[model samples]
Target: MAEPQPYESALDAIPGAHPYPRSSRYHDAEVGIHTQPDGTAVRYVKRRLLPPLGEADEDIATHTVSSGERPDHLGQRCFGDPAAWWRIADANPVLDPRELTAEPGEEIALPDGFPGGGGRFGR
Candidate 1:
């Protein structure tokens, strides 16, 4: 198996709140596959199956960053799920949420509300 890539970990009140940015791709797939020469009569190259990324998301709300805040905190405040901080990160595509949070007034865009009904949304 190929070595795993490291990603930034999210800190929060809950466990497993942070998911690996790109996870289990290598170990979850096959590699070093050898095929018979005369390929047409033998096996074929491998291609990984990918899940659909889904449709575009509309903006639900905009937030003004406040001092000493973290992505997880904003996530909990906005979506009731601290783990959902990635949603905030994904929407803005910023390199660092900590910088945004420390900026103390930077406007951040929040993704659209969750499609399904209930208190749950994009967590």
Candidate 2:
């Protein structure tokens, strides 16, 4: 396993300020502060580049989308946590997760190593 990268937050200098939660997709993304001409500070998250599908390694799994199945539902059915939908998103090429199941019978790739395994899709 690759060593976990250190997380640095622009808000870290502020007392009691915390970065995005671990469950958030942007949790590992960097935050930047831009100072406007009016002397106002605007904080924004840096663009996050999606990891290549190969990053999931050789343990990839597949899921067939069913009617009314959403990313969160797939996350819950595969990883036992609705918030883990991002993991599925990371494994696929969809820019918007909702499109992952917009068409029934569509197949999407799932990364391994998550809880609950990636076999069931709540069918």
Candidate 3:
């Protein structure tokens, strides 16, 4: 019925708000803006490039997918934290996390130890 006010996400209300944790793949992504012909400003996050699969291959460990295995659970089993599942995704070629354990008896590579301690993460 009326013009909308400028959009400021709830997270923007908090000073130094960071939606992604340091361990997240998006932690270092940059924010970008685009302008329409009407001059309205649109903000968005820039595309994030995935690290090459081999980056996480250092000190690699393998786990055979069992029936009903989940990525979060696999992350916990491999890296001690379910939230670190992306680490597993980064080490493999699959674009979807679910594909990591979609088939029973499939082998997946995992980077051992802290993300950046020796692995290529935290770059």
Candidate 4:
């Protein structure tokens, strides 16, 4: 087998290597952050496949909420239905469907199934 190449630094191992931001808004030492000219920041988090704390594995979900998008829009994008707002509501326990609103740059959990249809619904 060929010899493994030594990483120059921790950042080199990452797929997209970019300089850390000066603001340190989302910098986690373990994970790197990338800043955009539009004043938006993107965080690169690292997690192992296996459970980190206990024997049971955990499900960690991440999402970026953009401006002018309601829960219904996200449901439609993920599950292909605007009426399936419950998916978004359920994912975001802090949110109220009656007055749904998502802040830009806010990350939220995406529902498993919203517009529950496709394979089963067709048949």
Candidate 5:
């Protein structure tokens, strides 16, 4: 069985609510190599912050946040995958998740009606 994640994932109730090192967003970047004095090259892989996906002409739905919500939770509820939380952020584009769902009665845009954020997400 899959563990139940909160709608507002950044909520304090969830254990380890924050992603471990901001999740796998850095996997896209190439690793850097450092030359050592002993003629050996040490390779280091650092996590990279990616540019946010922009909003486009896509069908969407509204979700009323009731405190303790996270993008992953909404994504899971609406798109069936927690990873799709970024979609919520993209639709709303709040600099911080806290601001996205700050109040208990705040409303955020939830993508629905198609796959992959309503399909054909433009760059």
Candidate 6:
């Protein structure tokens, strides 16, 4: 059997790339290197914006819903408006509104249509 190749850290994988400056709010930014088997290397920078704590917490709540849970139910429970299901559906572009349903361990975006807007539950 062939021995498994050792995994390389992101920093080791890329050359001439350093961690983002501390002054930058996005600490997760890093340089990524892609190399061909023959050793030709290409470097690229990647940056990710971490979500706020509130959004993170809400995402956790969204993940707790079961696969069978209805989208309307999610809207009602999270936003206090069952009709706001459309907003939730809209935010989750990955899922189709006509087939909105949560799967186990899936995180869904919470709808932000709070009463005064023209959104589903808007006044």
lDDT of each: 0.52, 0.72, 0.69, 0.48, 0.56, 0.49
Candidate 1, lDDT over the whole model: 0.52
Q: Mind sharing the TM-score for model 3?
A: 0.66
Off by over 4 Å in 6: 1-62, 113-123
Candidate 1's residue-wise lDDT over 1-123, tens digit each?
Answer: 133334322332235443222222222233434556766444233554432233334434567877888988877776676766766665564678666476788887666642211122334
Q: What TM-score does candidate 4 reach?
A: 0.39
- Which lDDT tens digits does candidate 2 get at residues 52-112? 6666566777778889888888888876789888888877888898988899998888877
Best TM-score among the predictions, by candidate number = 2
Better structure of 3 and 4 per TM-score: 3
* Candidate maximizing lDDT: 2
lDDT of 6 by residue, 1-123 (tens): 122245423543465343542222233356679898999998766755333434433323233447577877766665566665654554555446645563566665553431211222221
Scanning candidate 5 in windows of ten residues, the lowest lDDT window is 114-123
| lDDT for 53 (candidate 6) | 33
lDDT of 3 by residue, 63-108 (tens): 7888998999876766566787887887778879999999999998
* lDDT of model 4 at position 21: 31
Candidates in descending TM-score order: 2, 3, 5, 1, 4, 6
For every candidate, C-alpha RMSD to the true structure in Å: 11.9, 6.0, 10.4, 17.8, 10.3, 16.9
Off by over 4 Å in 3: 1-16, 112-123
Native-to-model Cα distance after best TM-score fit, residue 98 in candidate 3, in Å: 1.6
Candidate 4, residues 1-123: lDDT per residue as tens digits?
122246534555565563343112123236747889998898766541211222211232446777787876765775566665554555454637744454788776554332222211111
**How many pairs in model 3 have backbone atoms within 3 A of each other, for residues 3 or more apart or on separate chains, i.e. clashes?**
0
User: Candidate 2, after superposition: displacement of residue 56 in Å?
Assistant: 3.7
Residue-by-residue lDDT tens digits, candidate 5, 83-110:
7666567567688756766787887766
